[model samples]
Target chain A: MPLIKEGVLAEDNWQSLADEDNLVDGPIVVSLERWQEERESLLARNTPLGLRLRSDQSPALVVDDLERFSVVALEFPKFADGRAYSYARLLRDRYGFKGEVRAVGHVFRDQFLLMQRCGFDAFEVADPAAVEAWEQAVSEISVTYQPGADARRPALALRRSRPAVA
Target chain B: MYRYDEFDHTLVSERVHQFRDQVERRLAGELTEDQFKPLRLMNGLYLQLHAYMLRVAVPYGTLSSTQMRKLAFVARRYDKGYGHFTTRQNIQFNWPKLEETPDILAELAEVEMHAIQTSGNCIRNTTSDQFAGAAADEIEDPRVYCEIIRQWSTLHPEFTFLPRKFKIAVTGADHDRAAVRVHDIGLQMCRNEAGEVGFEVIVGGGLGRTPVIGQTIREFLPKQHLLSYLEAILRVYNQLGRRDNLYKARIKILVRSEGIESFSRMVEEEWSHIKDSALQLPLDEIARIENYFAAPRYEHLDDNVREFEVKRFEDREFASWVRTNVTAHKQPGYAVATISLKPVGKPPGDASAWQMDAVADLAESYSFSEIRVTHEQNLVLAHVKKADLYALWLGLRDLELATPNAGLLSDMIACPGLDYCNLANARSIPVAQRISERFSDLERQHDIGALKIKISGCINACGHHHVGHIGLLGVDKKGEEFYQITLGGSADENTAIGKIVGPAFSYDDVVGAVEDIVDTYLEYRTDGEEFNDTYRRVGLAPFKEKLYAAH
Candidate 1:
């Protein structure tokens, strides 16, 4: 899998640990269940902790512990299961967690832009060959209608600020 | 009547290019059908039973003559020389090659139209009253808010992929011509005691397998907070709506299972958070959108046109057409006229390219180049001068578009059942054609008066069978077609789901069953009572006994 960040393939530094795996020292990601069950131990040895949430898990469950993690990865489960998109927005806009929100599981090139708008900064792609298509996908739609967590101003605001037509 | 500004133009143009790329990928096998299905559906392209069915959204059912002509062009060039005006007030081309869809969308964009959000699990096209701006009894024009919802819901990042497809409808007038009560979210424009116009927000009224009339979540939602409130509802549904079972995914099931009070509380809580956010509509922005729907210029004239009156008195046929098709307009000299697509022994809602071009010509010549597609599968010229009514009727009669059966039994809403839809278990159009032929007599149809016969092939209820005055659901019993009947469903301000009458009627006997039901209504009805009112007063026993007497 290739990690796309800031419109280009980036090296993934965080190690995602399985439920049975031993904890490592450097930046590591664990499942939400693991974070909940081993909260005290993980926090004591917190070497740049990251939390992974499934499609059904809400970011609100970990709202109080958001500042403790440097990264929060949201799973798509499937591309059509879009609960993660709302989760990303909640993490960024509602909880105001200034951290890397990564999209994992079934993330494709076409969904890169939408995920970005919903505040995902990184995506794990199934095909490394399609990394070049990521940039094109994100920039294909230069105009949008709704205001998102992304910095791009919505068309309504742009229309209001633009000089009135004669 | 809202024209696309620069932002809209850019967005639509870019979307065309994007879809073109996706189609190219699909053809080249870079993307499988599984991955490309949602992308194509979101762009309003569907791989139906026969070929690609491209549904083009007519925003709030409004179309300029240029757009209608372009639709005609697409029908001739790409499709099978015809289009089907859908129950959602959009148009569907039933036979476009998948390869040619990008070209079709590009051409549609030239006329400031694209098929975005017309399909898929995203927020579908926001439908509204066909007579929005021109209606005499309107509180305020619903098109402004519909356009506003269109912008906010188009390519909405957070809410696109939900458990099921979402539909929203708005009705401005006291009469619910848009069928607002049967949508996922229904907005009825109303005024408070202080004379402030707002919305009565209704949530989770849908007509599919589990039909439920929506409950009022808010009695009065201030006009400015419409988008925010909608966002709140969508958020709650997206986060909590059932995704485990496909049949239970609709918001109606959620509202039903959780009860409306609890659902309303959740929506209110969510709304309180985002009601003051950027989603809150600004006054200037509302004014800007409202300006687009501002009334067309009209010359002052007396309401009574001497020529129209004389022609109506002399020509009985013309008088009958006017009495059925013409509706009152707010402007004194103007009227709203419906061009019936349901002719004798023809499929309802099927308009040939030639008819589309003819309609465009009539609209351009008489109605300020504007047209409307109604949810009843009819076309409306919403702003015709009363004096020009005779000429319009002549033009329509030549094209066979003037059926003089508006709101009559023959003007049915039938889905393209097993004929073109994979989901359909039985055929709908042939049954509708048979029923229409049975009641083809104009005088008898006028005598029946204001009966809606909606038919659906399956339980999905695309034909709005649950809301029809005489609802018919085509079912498959032992691999043969049989029709089940329901009586007294109405989709107006007083919306109610019809009750099932009795056992199903065989294909050979279904039209006769409908006739029997109508005959029963006539037999029992008092003077001035419509079919719905008659059924409401007398109950369904008479219709059921009459329909199932042989059995």
Candidate 2:
């Protein structure tokens, strides 16, 4: 599945299989190996760069490389390993990567909201109907306990002040 | 106690609904077990050996009687008529089905509670002084600061995925009953010479396989810099803590490797950059959080020394309970009463639904309707009046809650070892029960004098065996259960890591070995020295000599 979304794919399209070469010029997908092979190649290119899935990769390394590439894709090899979720969050907040994070893998409908909250903008869900469900999930909750790219003030900070009435 | 404002309540309510949807999807086969694992864990639900376990955060062990009763209802309706109080001050119910977890969480939400971040690699429950508000030497209620940390660390994005789980403990008392020294980060509240209250920060103390007492990183941190200092510590830990080895990933190893001086310098360097940022506590906001914990309207009460003494002399049982279970409160007329969960032959820290409801009722009647759960597995009513001690004793006796063994040999800190927890290697509660029975005589326990016997079913140390004065660590030798005894460990002001005695003992011989050690200490004691004093003065050598003499 694709980890980065570009002009080619829809806002909801995120999954990319290994070099199924299935690209309609939607987004520039960069695998960890591919990203490493052409780190300078992607940085010099005029398109958004993506990082594809590696089964035994740490997100910390990819997060460290964010300054060189604009768009980074974090692949979920089997969907059960949550090291990617932590990577997605660290990439967005700690490393200050403000580009699209596409979660592509055995992406299911259930994890759509949590993935989104952890800073995944575009999700490559397998089923077509799952994408629509994911869209609904993102706007479902208006509040969260954590502070990340989505919100700055923690859930408590807002409570310290009173609402201004017009 | 921190009251849930609109934001806090809204966040939990939304999370409940979100988890409800996640649960629905899982049930419909839209989510696999692998997919649902993290989601359920973030909500504090775990699929254990037999059934799903839900861990509800207690937020520094402060709870209203209403909250306690609600927990009792959850235990009665959804669980096996009981709940296990964990060392982190959270409560775990072991028998909820997968499908029923969302509903249980929804019920928990009604009382401003949830199981969020309890089991996840994210921030676990923030534990603090159980005697927070009413401690004699407290600068301010530690719960307010704990609530602040609770808000700051709850689902915090940057620090959530550390090398492993993180724990924090805070103490605002002079005596440090909260065991701050053994936490990942321990905060001790102290007033500066200028009369401003601040924290003395200690970093890298934890228990598991590599147990190390936290070293002081900051001698005295300004009150307003609390959050910022914490950010520095966590940032350092998150970036540098060893993750390649699961066993060596905790901050203790990092602190040990980096050494305290270098680690403190690094934290200071990080703090210098973020000192004036948004993370620093704004003066106004500190007041806002502190406002909730202002002392309740208390009437001037007469000092009941004569009345209490008269009652104690009148009844031997009341005197016995007062001597063992009661503690001096900061308030003139108040005393802290610890109701022991370890009655003889009962599982340690396991409270049944009826017993919980009874404690809730008692809290309402005698302790200003509040109850606190200690990490040591005892419940405290922090504000009991001296005048009402006799009546409280009688009421507690009726409910079988008055064990009169608080801080004594019978008040054992035990983990639900092999019987419940999948991580445990041996049965812990049975060993505790056997030991309690051996020391069931009140006179014997009284003679033992402020001794703590902590039992862990395994090396996970959920029973806090490393810090117990007389620690019993359960190990499996050739698939046979054996106990490893440690002496001189403590979690108080003078915290010392326990030293192991001779060879590991068989299951049947563990209690006898403990009795022999106590007998040895009694024989070698000088005047009024307690077990720890004697152990310190004579060293573990004498106990070891007595223990393995006949072997």
Q: Each prediction's DockQ?
A: 0.82, 0.28
Positional deviation of residue B171's Cα in model 2 after best superposition, in angstroms: 0.5
Output the number of the DockQ-best candidate: 1
What docking grade applies to model 2? acceptable
Candidate 1 lDDT over B1-551, as tens digits, reads 78888889999999999999999999999989998998999999889887888999999999999999999999999988999999999999988988989999999999999999999888999999998889989999999999999999999999888989999999999989987888999999999999999999999999999998888999999988998899889988998899999999999999999999999999998888788998888999989888988899988989988998999999999999999999999998899999999998999999999999999999999998999999999999999999999999999999999999998999999999999999998999999999988887889999889899999999999998989998899899999999888888999989999999989888899999899989989999999999888988999787777776755
The true-versus-predicted C-alpha distance at residue B86 of model 2, in Å, is 2.4
For candidate 2, lDDT tens digit of each residue in B270-363?
A: 7886677667787877888888888765657776667888999999989999998998887888889999888999988889999899899888
Worst 10 residues of 2 chain B by lDDT: B154-163
Off by over 4 Å in 2: A2-68, A74-98, A101-120, A123-130, A151-153, A161-166, B265-273
lDDT of candidate 2 over A23-129, digit per residue (tens):
43445665677667656755665555566655346556665666655556666665444456656756665667877666766676655556666687766656766
For each predicted model, how many residue pairs clash, with residues at least 3 apart or on different chains? 0, 12
